[model samples]
Target: MRFDFEGKTALVTGAASGIGRAIALELGASGALVVISDLDAEACRSVVEEIAANGGNACVFAADVSDEDAMREAVEFAQRKGGDLHMAVNNAGIGGPSVPTGEYPAADWRRVIDINLNGVFYGMRWQIPALLRAGGGSIVNMSSILGSVGFAKAAPYVAAKHGLLGLTRTAAMEYAQQGVRVNAVGPAFINTPLLSANLSPETLEALAVMHPMGRIGTPEEVSGLTCFLLSNRASFITGSYHLVDGGYTAP
Candidate 1:
């Protein structure tokens, strides 16, 4: 069955580009009033403009997910734009400190925890109460295959993503009876611009070979599963982590 979010309101973080931007646009196109946010003010507005140009409902807010005040304001801005809050995608994050834990710089470690882990937490901390007031909603936290398993040189990121699962599960349990659902989407080697910061041709080939499907993934691929989890189609699917990886975890 097709999932439709007609008349719903959604707020997506890190929506300036990549997976976050795609998710925001897709949700808007699906009949939801969308509020797109990013750390970059201009980029966030640009994405919102693009969404509007495509005949979707959207507005933009600039905020750093790591900043408690900024995230709070973003949600407030979304509510003012949409007139209500029904859903949110806590997708703002960064892969920080790719070295061994012992050697990982303290500054880098803090940055990863601040954005990757703490930022998600902040988003949820503020969003949950808002969702409750709006009669409950769904929240999708962006995770990665790294959330389930591990890889070399990504200790901080792996640790943070793992912690996110624990948070998602706990929140889902706590809110299951409250008309709210919390879930996660864990993708593997999705070809988003984020990859440009790390993966090169050689590494891309290695990643493609690593997945049992013999291919990487796309942001839209992840968004498809995410939208499902956000809609009523996944009403009974809270507290679960859905992997959108190309069978990378399978033996």
Candidate 2:
């Protein structure tokens, strides 16, 4: 799908891989000056090079999303490279250890919350003002299907995702009159490098069965909806959670 992002600037966290990378590349292809951000500097550069090769404009910004200062610097870097920030995808996150709530370690819980939930908060802390300064823009927080429903043995991740929806809605309502829109995208199991590396073939197949479509989603599938929300086409859509879950949450 073609989106008109000419003269706009977009920042995508976790752009080194997975859905974030797909979104960054899509934004670049749509004519937005993309700021590819992730912890891996070299991987970020690689994504930028790919964008350039495709005749799109992009730059790299390496930062750990869990760090408030680093997130601030990321927004600043985006402004420095492409003027005011017009769009942002707070997509950086990590899946903490899988354990029952009773067995979940305090440190692991904090770490998960820090990266998955606090990270988005930190990104928006800086991004919201930047978007306002740009005369209004869009922000998409990458939530997961777990945001809408509970999954056993993933308490921290589920709790963080659920919290993100509230954050997204609050920000959306707060900025609605100001023309800055905030929304969240919830995706189900997606076939990405991280999933491929972590899950066995049998495990993946089992996951696919959970979706009504009988298969895991792709990063590009999630990116398409993300880019749509960021585009002007979704001007009236805000404070909403859009799911790209292949009917995973339908039943």
Candidate 3:
């Protein structure tokens, strides 16, 4: 669907690459003054340049989503740079060590939960208020197919993604009447840098077959759903989960 975000401002976390980067670019191209955020300053700047090159407005905000204070500062940075915070995409996450739940490394589990689950809460903590101040806005929290189903050797990631659904729903209910809309997006394994870094080609191919579509998805595919949710076109959509999983969960 076509969307115009003129005069709007959006903050996207984990926007250095992958799905987050796609979302940032989509919003920017649609006319929103976008704030690109991630852990790496250089990577975030690169996204900013890409947005600018497309004749779209964007800026970089480097911050660790796992850090509560840093998350708040990131939101504030968007407000200062873009004049308002009308939309937010909390997409920062990590896949922990691949080990069975019983043998999962405690540290890795904590770290995954910190970034995937807690980071989203931190983003909402700051983002919700800013959205309210902007006279209401929208939020899209990135979940996964794992949010609904279990995955072997990914206990932490599964658990964290599941937790995001509850958070998204609660926040949506609380603010549904107040103006802000909150929702979660669940994607099956997409061909992102993180997936490439962690999985071998053979493993990825095997995983691709797990989806009925016989292939993996892409960042732009997920971004299409995300930007739709962020726009007025989805005014009635909130406090729910939408899947772009290539029928991965059809079973």
Best by lDDT: 2
Alpha-carbon local distance difference test for all models: 0.88, 0.96, 0.95
> After superposing candidate 3, which stretches have Cα over 4 Å from the reference?
none
Candidate 2 lDDT tens digits, 112-208: 9999999999999999999999999999999999999999999999999999999999999999999999999999999999999999999999999
Question: What would the TM-scores of all predictions be?
Answer: 0.96, 0.99, 0.98
Error of 1 at 46 (Å): 2.5
Query: Candidate 2: where is the Cα deviation over 4 Å?
Result: none
**TM-score of candidate 3 relative to the true fold:** 0.98
lDDT of prediction 3: 0.95
The positional error of residue 248 in candidate 1, measured at the CA in angstroms, is 0.4
RMSD of 2: 0.6
Among all windows of ten consecutive residues in candidate 3, which has the lowest summed lDDT?
92-101
Ranking by lDDT: 2, 3, 1
For model 3, give the RMSD to the true fold: 0.8
lDDT of 3 by residue, 1-251 (tens): 77999999999999999999999999989999999889898998999999999999998889999999999999999899888899999998988788998999899999999999999999999999999999999999999999999999999999999999999999999999989999999999899998998889999999999999999999999999999999999999999899999999998
> Could you tell me which 10 consecutive residues in candidate 2 have the lowest summed lDDT?
74-83
